[model samples]
Target chain A: MANSNTQADFRTRLQDWIPKLVLSPSLAAMLVFVYGFIAFTVYLSFTGSKMLPKYDWIGFENYARLWGLSHWWTAITNLGIFAFLYITICTIIGLGLAIFLDQKIRGEGMLRPIYLYPMALSFIVTGTAWKWIMDPGIGIENTMHLWGWESFEFGWIKDRDMAIYTVVIAAVWQTSGFVMAMFLAGLRGIDNEILKAAQIDGASNWNLYRRIVIPLLRPAFLSAFVILSHLAVKSYDLIIALTGGGPGRATELPATFMYSYTFTRNSMGIGAASAVIMLMTIAAIMTPYLYAELKEKA
Target chain B: MSVATQDTAVSTGRVTRTFIYLLLILFALFYLMPLFVMVANSLKPLPEITGGNMMALPQDWTIEPWLQAWSSAQIGVEPTGLKPYFLNSVLMVVPAVAISTVLGALNGYVLTKWRFRGDSILFGLMLFSCFIPFQIVLIPMAMILGKLGLAGSIPGLVLVHVVYGVGFTTLYYRNYYAAFPTELVRAAMIDGAGFFRIFWRIMLPVSGPITVVSVIWQFTNIWNDFLFGASFGGQSQPMTVALNNLVQSSTGVKEYNVHFAGAILAALPTLLVYIVAGRYFVRGLMAGSVKG
Candidate 1:
């Protein structure tokens, strides 16, 4: 009897430890790869590291130099324009599509997939398609000329002044469908009785949506805003594939700026600083949201 | 059902309904036009694209561009085409997705069924990793890969993807298993089923939906990833990088048709996944956002 009890106790103890053991590998990986690597990058930013990561403390010198560079300013300015336009346009189109599709439309099944297939595509693929279509020599401009519109001119891909807008167009095309899906999900989850009640109260369609439905979609709006803003900030693949950072530095955002500095330009310190800034920007937006989410669950 | 029928609040007139359908169709066309252009141009010969209407169906359809993109097109000094890179991506994505999913299932199982102190904090940590701009880890990750002698290789890419992907996969499984009844897990445990046994038999058998969600999400993201493939991919560049090289190489006469074919080739796998399992794809997207 004593032997069996100890054996049972040992099995229970081992079983208890098994869960922790199983979780440790992933937790350790997150710590080392995610948190540890983040620390290393932050440390690299404070040092005089360039060309390679050197261990000499320099105390924000890279940041000061980073701030002074005209190229950096251009990247920041481009990012502001890109993020603002990208978010606003995607939201408007996405919400519009969602509202329309929610109205018991025919062929909704076929249309939703069409709207979302772009989200499945790599930004590179999207970029290549858009780049070709936007190319003046062989793309839309040429096609327009061929079809008897001799005065057509759509050279935004090659034009320095308007290249960024082309990026916005491709991005919107790729993601608006996804935003629509989120809103649709939100719309579906809404309590229908409330809508009926509001209808019985004689609210017009416009007033019903504006006063009841739209307000109820607050979570969806927050999710879209957060997701879109982060995507805009981390926008890299599309920029590289579509504009290659420009018709001459016209579309250089912070992501491209970080890569060029770190890998190509041998300014690892500056790149690290820029990367830290990017992390902080995302964290500022993400931390409180995460805290709220996790705390609510708790 | 009746409430759902009346949920639209105000029924619209025929004109408004027609207008709504028209607007939806227009937006759908807008969404699909680029894809249509790509498909159409990819089938046409070079001159048709350069000198003819892009919106027009190909007058002389040919698969030459597709063949060239798959096998003979020049990619960064190599005439090896996207075949090898596509293979590399497959190898990278498969292992990365598999390992991360398994790890995530275990982690999710533990976090939900086998509760522990500070588990929520740990989960919060894992979840936050999903949203970090990966730029911060690029330099250090490169250094780590170099140290491990895995730099620029397929394995290196796999390792990086799995490490980053665990957070997302974990989130999926956790949210899923949270809704699962603990009674089954408890009954299995009382019957002397070991950890792996219970998980394999009880948790995993019922984990199909979330698994689909996790796999589709991981496959798409890993296949479509460009920044890592470029930074760490060195010699074994993935399809996205290779496609970019094929399209962006400025030395040769630009073959727009070939470029479109290559882009389509790069897009096919994820596109296939989306078409086959788009419901789960949307579920993954929604789950990733608006966290449970």
Candidate 2:
């Protein structure tokens, strides 16, 4: 009996240690690959690591140069345009679709899947299909001309001034369905009693939504905004697939700037600098949102 | 049973309901047009596409473009088509998804059921891993890959994806396992089942739904990834990179049919998943949004 008891005690200790052993590998990998790399990126941003990484500290020279470059300015301005329009349009369209679908319209089960199919596709695929569709000579414009609308010029894709907007169109199409789904989930979570009480108070439909339901959707709205904001900043694949930065660098986003400089242009230090900036911006958005969520759960 | 339940809050007359249906139909058409156009044009000859009649059904259907895109499409100096890269993506996705999901199942089991000190912080650290942009890791990842001698290779790309993907897989499993009954684990322990034994015999059989969610999510994400594919994948790029090359490659003439075919081929797997397991996909999304 004593021998058996000792063996059981030994086995229990082994079981307790096994989970930590299983978990440590992933934890270590995340530490080294994710956080460690972030620190390395921040460090590289300050060094004169051009062409190849040289660790000699340069004291913000890369950032200074990054700021002074016209190309960088173009990328920042385009990011501004893309992020603002992408978020605003997706939010409005998503909200509208969610409300419309909430009315219990028929064929929703089918239509909802159709709306989400694009989200299933890679941005590369989205970019290509939209590129073909947006092609002026062979696409919408040409079709319009054949229908006797000869002057229906929808060549925003080729126009340097309007190419960024074309990106917005493709991105909105790619993601609005997902945003709609999020909003629909939010709408479903609304308490029916509050809605009934509002209805009983003789409130109009618009007034009921405006006063009670919409306000009640604050968490969903905030999550959507945070999600959309980060996605906008990380907008690389769509731009690459759709516009390839543009007719004349007209749609250059920070992500593209980072890639071109890092690998293509061989301006590694500057690329690292731009990457750090992108990280800071996203961190600024994600930190508080994640904190709130984790705190609530705790 | 009807999916549409009458809502007293937004109830309206027949005319308003008809208008809502019309609005929904128009939006659906708008959303599906690109897919319709791609399918239509991929079946047509070059003349029809260049002739600017895209919205019509293909008068002369052909599977040649798909074959061309799959076997003979030009990308950069090589004209090796998307087949090799498609294989590469498959190779990368299968291992990455499987490994990450398994690790996540274990990690989630430990974090949720076998609670330990500092588990939440560790979970937070792992969760934050998914948030950092891929670009932040490019400079160091290149160095790390070189040091490990896995740079610019399929294995290296898989490593990158798996390393990053563990966070999300862990998130899914942890959330699912959090809701799991720990009493079962306790009962299994009382029976003298070892840790791995309990996991294999007890936890895994019940983790089927979440495993589907994790697999689909990881498969779609790893397969669709371009940033990692473009950066770490060597001579044989992933399908997304190859598709990008096929589109951007200024080789011969711009073959719209081939481009359309390649785009559709790249999307086929995820599209298939969405078609087949859509409810699980939507449920996966709800699980994510509800928690984070």
Query: What TM-score do all the candidates reach, one by one?
Result: 0.97, 0.96
Best by TM-score: 1
Per-residue C-alpha lDDT of model 2 across residues B80-143, encoded as one tens digit per residue: 8788888999988999999999999999999988888899999988877788888999889988
In candidate 2, which residue ranges exceed 4 Å CA deviation? A1-6, B1-9, B284-292
lDDT of 1 by residue, B49-145 (tens): 7778888999999999999999999999999889999999999999999999999889999999999998999999999999999999999999999
Q: Pick the candidate with the highest lDDT.
A: 1
DockQ for every model, please.
0.77, 0.69
User: Lowest summed-lDDT stretch of 10 residues in model 2 chain B?
Assistant: B1-10
Best by DockQ: 1
lDDT scores in order: 0.91, 0.88
Q: Per model, how much of the real contact set is kept? A: 0.82, 0.71
RMSD of 1: 1.6
